[model samples]
Target: MMNIKETIIFAPETFNLAETTRSIEVAKECSHVFHCIFMGYSKKYSYLIEESNFTFIHLEPHLSDKQITQIMNVDQMNGIKHPFTYEHIKERVQNEKRLIKIYQPVSIVIGTTLSMFISSRVCNTPLVYIKPLAYTRPYFEEGYLPSPFTSMNLLAATIKKLFISIALRITYKPKSFTKVAKEENVSLPKYTIDALDADYNLITTTPEISQVYNLPDHYQYIGPVYAKLDVPIPKFFDHLPTDQPIIYFAMGSSGSPNIIVKLLHILSELKVTVVCPMKRMIKSQLHKLSFNENIILCDFLPAHKISKFIDLSIIHGGEGTVQTACLTGKPFLGFGLQQEQRVNINQCVRFGNALSFRKKDFTKARMEQLINHALSTRTIKEKALEIQQVLKDINGPENAAKFLIKHFTVT
Candidate 1:
């Protein structure tokens, strides 16, 4: 048996800890597992990973005075044609190498929006790219951004694309485009590895049905690996009227507090019971709303457990949250903010299991209207059940482990 050393790196704030947990479970079967993370190092995650017998490394960059000044300069010159130079790329590449050497792992696993794209080129190590949650297709079709490029003729669209491409090359050098260009020009250093040539790219989605990007042979859809938690219902959940349906509302970790307040107010006007995860910034705001016996507030609740009792969920469309909602067979009313959330909302809508609203479109009246429409719809409910059945049929984390063992183990 070949003993392997593996490192999985990701940002701490992302809601993909369940996926990381799954990865660790698989890694332990044949190798030693190490975790690399940034920011958000909570006791919950630390305790969880410790129980799995994995080592954790935290990287929090403390910028020097000179480096801070340089970063400020880069920020100010946002419009500069060449914002990121060879020097910038070199600095990042060196930093990554230093971090990896501390662990001395045989292979690395990366999650987050662009970590794979950056690390694969910088560290020159074998890597696996985990897909973050996103909308598949139908959501995008309904959610349109006001685009000058799309409105103009084909010539204008082409011109804008060319201009944006050049601007991106200048600002985010050593990005996917520049990496490919550098390889072709023989400028990529010997230490740099092309992610396009990676051994495998594992996506946490069903590619057979997802509409975003085609699944290449190198890319495998491994389904959702969300962490499951058992949440004890507080006294509040039990007292709420069991006759009427419950609505779950959360703005995720970084969502705007104002939005949460607006949602609470809208829910109070309706007959449905509203459950919100108490956030500090919005606590006072929530207090101002007249409490109908229907409002329930708590600091934190296990979303999966709560979804079982709730008929609908209003969320920021975080991948983990959305997947949990799907597992419980509950339809969602997604309020998407970031690009990734938009993608998740899109997928939910495509699956016919959710509806989405952009942050800008969320008004008290609009929210009430949307919620009422969803409550009246039987199709969404049916779809939710179908997706729930699909989730039940798959052994998500186990299957993902099997794939990793097959491809990553060195003979």
Candidate 2:
């Protein structure tokens, strides 16, 4: 087998530590040169680089933005692209080219939106899209269609309009940054179609639960790559109360803190264990909130381990988090923080495995109602359990590793 140098470019702050670390570990097994890029701050994922398990090279993150907030809001799919934002695109394009030249990367794996767009514009690098950065499904996939003309019925049309509106965000660029590429160089993709133009599109979701259909030959649905957290169990879980229902909740990076705090208060009062893994920034605010013995807070907790005790989960509609909920045989209530989450929520609800709510539609009573519904509903629980078996049987990480290795071996 011939081993070539491979550079894995991840979007800063979006790609979690476990997925990146495991991919690096797997790539090393085949003797590929593994290089990574990260920027800003990631207290949760930074430990992978600091604690060495292999020879992974650290590369600079692409920080080319005309305005920091503008780029973030745009990159986050919360903002529209500025027609006059030529300099910013050029810098990003130049930065990507520079990194490609420096590392001499053969295969580029993207896990976020901006990186996906960057890879689309890259000249020769083969892109391996790991997960959905946008809510694009296979063209023939059955369910709510995004196109205005395709909706055959009134309900379908209504849903299509709703999802489409949510997909388009009005982002504001807060501050500008240093330019790495020239103003005259790069042109950004205007649509999801242009952004996803890659050599390989690897989906981590299973076909059984997905609305996506008619995948092309280059695309692969390998199942869920659930994060493997080494963090110890929280002390609250030391004693088990099997009688009452328990729920694991995460607001994710994009979730609103005020909403989470409000929900926590309600969950605490419901006489059930609410296991919430919070980011450190939210740690202080949690002190102000009241909690009963059933409310447990931690900096980190393994979802797989913790899900054993949880009856349901509440998440900000991330794919990885959804996979965790599904693979653990627990239903997750998707509280969408962004537009893309609505895509996942639609699919999960369509398949009858999970419940969902848009943030705008959220109220304390609605949240409580959804929680109670998921817990009491047996059909969804059964479907969740069934999906769990399918996900386990698929062995997402191993199969994904194999797929990555095969690309290296063949080419």
Candidate 3:
């Protein structure tokens, strides 16, 4: 067998450290390793990758508005060539090819939306995709689906799933069918198709629970990659009343400002010391609020670590966020928007570890109501502990790394 040259790993700016860590682990096993990130490097991330002996290349051009918009649009379209003509495709291919050449990787692994789009277009190297993990099956099984198109049945419940599938298929033509084939010096298929035809499709999910999908032979479920960052707990947490059960309210990155404010208000009225991590979105607004002694406005804190202290978590159901909460065994009050998030929220609800309120349902009254309900429900707590034990039993990251090494045979 021919020994592989350097393998290039491409990820978006928003790619979490856990995913990055997993990628680096897989890359280290290969002969030589290189990386291309869409955004500039953080010292922490740079140090980690360097420690693994991989050459890091932060491709700044890929982070530009023009590039981001182009990539987002391509994903929104699902890889289909609409709006963008063949001429536009050619232009983009030419532009991206310059960066692709610099890395000179034998195989490329794409883990973020932007990187997925670019690699689909310009690189002829073998491709692998690492998707976020799926929620455990118990979560999906417990959700209530209303019946009939208009009735309160499971059929009604599946409508959201149906529309999401249609929307995704319509917008982003599968990269495999459109870009990958074209770049491989092969004929491009007429429409967007599944990503299975790639050299490998390593989904960040457990095989025991993934829903039915047309996955090809290359597909493998590698379980969740939970990233952790160290953060100091505020002195205030030590002073909070020990008797009162703590409830954490955080709407991960990209959460709506109005919702954050509403949650804060409700928590204050409830007299709960809610910890809200304000990222770039609502950081300024977080300062304006006159927080009661019960509310903690945190700019940056490691949520997984905090989960060990809190009784319940109110979140905007991102996969990574939910997985961390679950691993810690805290029940969730999920508020989700996008299709994937909704699915995760539904899964949490099914497992009896959570209850969800869609973004449309996020009103001050509803927030208060959900918080009250969550606090009152003993079953939710019991279920949370159950799932926590299950997650604890699984060696997620190490198992994922072992799978990649076994399948890819880096040595």
Q: Pick the candidate with the highest TM-score.
A: 2
Clashing pairs in 1: 18-227, 83-170, 134-343, 134-344, 135-343, 135-344, 135-347, 136-347
Candidate 1 structure quality by residue, lDDT tens digits, 1-411: 854445444323222344455454444534433333332223334445555555554333333434433433442342334323544444444455676666544555655323334545455666665555232122222222223344568887676666444433432234644654364342432222222334466666664335445544766777776655434667776667777779888765445566677667667777788888756547667556665667777766767676557888888766767777788787888876565666677677877988888656556678777887777789988998888887766655666667766765555
Winner of 1 and 2 under TM-score: 2
List pairs with backbone clashes in candidate 2.
67-175, 67-176, 68-175, 69-173, 69-174, 70-173, 70-174, 79-171, 91-181, 204-223
lDDT of each: 0.57, 0.60, 0.57
Q: Is candidate 1 or candidate 3 better by TM-score?
A: 3
Q: How accurate is candidate 3 locally (lDDT)?
A: 0.57
Error of 2 at 192 (Å): 4.4
lDDT of 2 by residue, 1-411 (tens): 755445554433323443454454334333443444432222445465445343333334433323433443554476875322445444555556666677655566655434334533455666776775345535323444423435589887767666655544323221221122112233443444544446677777776677556677878877776566656777667686888887888865555567777777777767577777774537668557677878777676777777677788888777777777887788878876555566666567777788877655456577778888887899988888877777777767666667766774344
In the range 70-163, model 3's lDDT, one tens digit per residue, is 5434433434332333444444445446656765554556555333354454466566666653322222233233212335567765784674
Q: Which ten residues in a row have the lowest lDDT in candidate 3?
A: 135-144
Candidate 3 wrongly placed segments (more than 4 Å): 1-6, 13-56, 60-102, 114-122, 133-198, 207-216, 232-235, 360-364, 409-411
**Candidate 1 root-mean-square deviation in Å:** 7.0
Higher-scoring candidate on lDDT, 1 or 3:
1
